[model samples]
Target: MNTISVQEADFDVGAEIEALSAGRCDVGAVASFVGLVRADTLAGGGDEVSAMTLEHYPGMTEKSLEAIVAEADGRWRLLGTRVIHRFGRLVPGERIVFVGVASSHRGDAFAACEFIMDYLKTRAPFWKKEDTPAGGRWVDAREADDSAAARWAK
Candidate 1:
């Protein structure tokens, strides 16, 4: 089973992973990633990020996420995958995103999880704004993220 969700409520990683591979005896490995809002960063003058708000086009965002997972599935032998992203106001240390992959081997599960996250970082149509002492500033796309996504190019 594949699960994709864009929500404002926080999620339980363990529950999602369990749901993804539930009753699937063939699954041997499950890889998961949980992204959290960082309070401190070197992005702008090493300011402390107090809070963040994320926005996205509802239908468009889910489609982009599904496409990313589809790409990963095509590249790896995945038994199941789950992606959950949160929007709206969030404070530092709050969970932001979750990616889970289940496969018969660790290699495929690991690679597919990373691939989905890398692509989501660059390809997903989500906009973020961080609140700092200086004020709220829109987050810019990181070239490093682009570079990471580019590695999967054929």
Candidate 2:
């Protein structure tokens, strides 16, 4: 079974991988990715983003992530997958995203990890609000994210 979680609490990447691989013999490769809150925006906004608040549509968000994982499962010979995205206020050093994929081969595992992240950036319902020195502002979605997701289109 695949697992997807959106929580305000932090998670341990090593523990998550151990849990997923435990008692599973078929899994040969596990590829994972973790996203962190960067200090600066891509647009070169001089104002340093001190904090970021992530918002999600709850039920819809989980469903969307599940669908993305399902697609990865179908495209590759995946044994398991896990995605944990955090919400609420996050500082620069905090982890914002996690994607893990287990497969029989490294290629599949690598592709699945990248695929999940790409889909999550564009397909997921999570939005960000940045707290800058000037004030707070809602972050707009980037076109590059859309283009990344577009690569997976059939």
Candidate 3:
């Protein structure tokens, strides 16, 4: 089964991975990534960020994420995938996102997990606003993120 969620609450990394790989004998490898909020380097030209609030159009966001997962599944020999992204006000050092992939081999799991992350960075319909000492400012898309996602294009 493939699980996709866009929630406001933080998630447990281990439990999510276990949910993805549980009772699956064919799954020989599980690859995962967890993204966290950092105060040191935030968007909007801030050296210190107090908190970041993520916003998304609920239904549209989930559909976009599902499409990303589907594309990766089609390209790789994956057993299952789970993607969970958090929205709302989040402080530094808080868990932001999780991407996990289960496959029969190390290569497929790693590639698919990375591919999913790369796509999610660019394709997901989530906007961020950072609360810095200077005040609140909306975060813009970074060119570096675009460059990373572009490599996967056909």
- Candidate 2 ranges beyond 4 A from true positions: 41-46
Each model's backbone clash number: 0, 0, 0
Rank the models by lDDT, top first: 1, 3, 2
Assess every candidate by TM-score.
Answer: 0.95, 0.94, 0.94
* Candidate 3: Cα lDDT at 63: 98
RMSD of each: 1.5, 1.5, 2.0
Residue 82 of model 1 has an lDDT of 93
Writing each residue's lDDT as its tens digit, candidate 1 over 29-102 gives 99999999988776456688899999998898999999998888899999999999999999998999999999
**Cα miss at 65, model 1 (Å)?**
0.8
Compose the digit string of candidate 3's lDDT tens values, residues 69-116. Answer: 999999999999999999999999999999999999999999999999
Local error of candidate 2 at residue 114 (angstroms)? 0.6
Report the poorest 10 consecutive residues by lDDT, candidate 2.
Answer: 37-46
Q: Residue 131 of candidate 1: its Cα lDDT?
A: 93
lDDT for each residue of candidate 2 in 22-100, tens digit (9 for 90 to 100): 8989988989999998777646567898999999999999999999999998999999998999999999989999998
Q: Candidate 1 local accuracy as lDDT?
A: 0.92
